[model samples]
Target: MQDEKLNPSDETPKPEAGGAEPEFDYIDAEELDRLKAERDEFRDKFMRALADAENSRKRSERDRREAEQYGGSRLARDLLPVHDNLRRALEAISDEQRAQSAALIEGVELTLRELHNVFGKHGITLISPQPGDQFDPQIHQAMFEAPVPGTVAGTVLQCMADGFMLHDRLLRPAQVGVSSNVG
Candidate 1:
């Protein structure tokens, strides 16, 4: 019997139903790409939400600090009238009466001193402009400008109303007359 020669293409390839072509479930490449993209998008959205929550927390903390700093603003404003009343009482009492009634004057003076001490403790400061002091627009409001021959121009001639400061911030500006050059 002659030996039968086998051609390379004459061999029948077995179907991949049994051997190791990695038994994988059929999945489309495009569909896989779409799924991966969706996962990435979800991850990005979660990160953004986390960042927003952190930012909101920081903002709330800042607001809380600001509230603490300015919490007594309304109360401070209301107490201003009490200060005004104290000043008025002192002014209303004449020097003759003060001399005649020493005990009454002393009591009034002591009360005024106590009030000022309380104001200082609460970070309230009086801004009383002395005559001939330089007029500062930031701290003083010019109610009127008048010519004064002796005093320098732009100097405070008189204070009509006392100003006040709460810490470093102006509570009220001093009302004053500014001196001008006399003709």
Candidate 2:
């Protein structure tokens, strides 16, 4: 016998007289279905991971914006007392005191005006409620309640101190006296 190399292309399929030879296939229907299922699971996992990354990015951006807007809230809160004191000093000044020290009065007035300007520039607003206005617990704190004749209950009898708002947030509630009268 002569040595020969068998070539796959040279082989011919043989069939029986009444039946055909079955073609050998590496992958069957069940294995194909399994591969499709595995691919679908991987795709689903990848989509979930992608969505999580997007959500995280959005959350980080929102936090950064909030920090930028409200970062100085503590400092702003600390300065409220100074503003209150300065206003009280001006209010306590008598006409005789103003006449005696016109320059001092003017200086204090200028300082107070400048502080108001700064507050306005920084989105800080004053919530000054007048007497007889409706008392709102949302922005006003009841320091005291008294029964006053001819005054409706829950009305603001007196505004002891002004409230402050930084942007839309309350830095401090306005201190007030509410009427406890039934009328």
Candidate 3:
């Protein structure tokens, strides 16, 4: 039998079923620069978008913490007047009245104590400034200033209405009368 292989000049080749992609052998310098710029622009935009997403996530976490810390402030402030009324009721009772109505006084006292306990359980604290104590602007609001004997200026002469705080935030500032230097 004779050899059957054909020479390159004598035979045509058929294309493959799935053709391979063509390679870029030589690109123009200006075209290459334009392609690089487009790539860089897309990369910069992607990086900026990622940074913005990260910042938004961090901000939302901070906002959530603040909301949790100060969420109950409004309700706690509303309850302040009730606490004042209860305190006033207790203070209004004299020795004779207390003795005459021992059972009623006991009930009222118990209720007040229970309310205090509840406040304590919920991280609520009383900002009760006592006589001769230094007045603090952060937790005390000066309702009026007066000259009092044997007290320095800015001293808390009396706390008119007690303040309350929830956690680390002030729910209400204590209404107070402070001493002035003026005679």
Best by TM-score: 2
TM-score of each: 0.68, 0.83, 0.79
Model 3 root-mean-square deviation: 4.6
Candidate 2 root-mean-square deviation in Å: 8.7
Tens-place lDDT digits, model 3, residues 107-126 = 98999899899889878999
- What lDDT does the true structure give each of the candidates? 0.85, 0.92, 0.89
Q: Which stretches of candidate 1 lie over 4 Å from their true place?
A: 1-47
Best by lDDT: 2
lDDT for each residue of candidate 1 in 1-183, tens digit (9 for 90 to 100): 999998989987655867745555777999999999999999999999999999999999999976765566678778877877877877888889888988987887888799789778878789999998999999999999989888888999999888988787788889999999653
Q: What is the lDDT of residue 77 in candidate 2?
A: 90
Q: What is the lDDT of candidate 2?
A: 0.92
Q: How well does candidate 1 match the true structure in TM-score terms? A: 0.68
For TM-score, candidate 1 versus 2, the one ahead is 2
The deviation in Å at residue 8 for candidate 1 is 35
By TM-score, how accurate is candidate 2? 0.83
Candidate 2 per-residue lDDT, tens place, 1-183, comes to 999988999988888677888678799899999999999999999999999999999999999987877788898899899889989999999999999999998998899889889888888899999989999999999999999999999999998899999899999999999999996
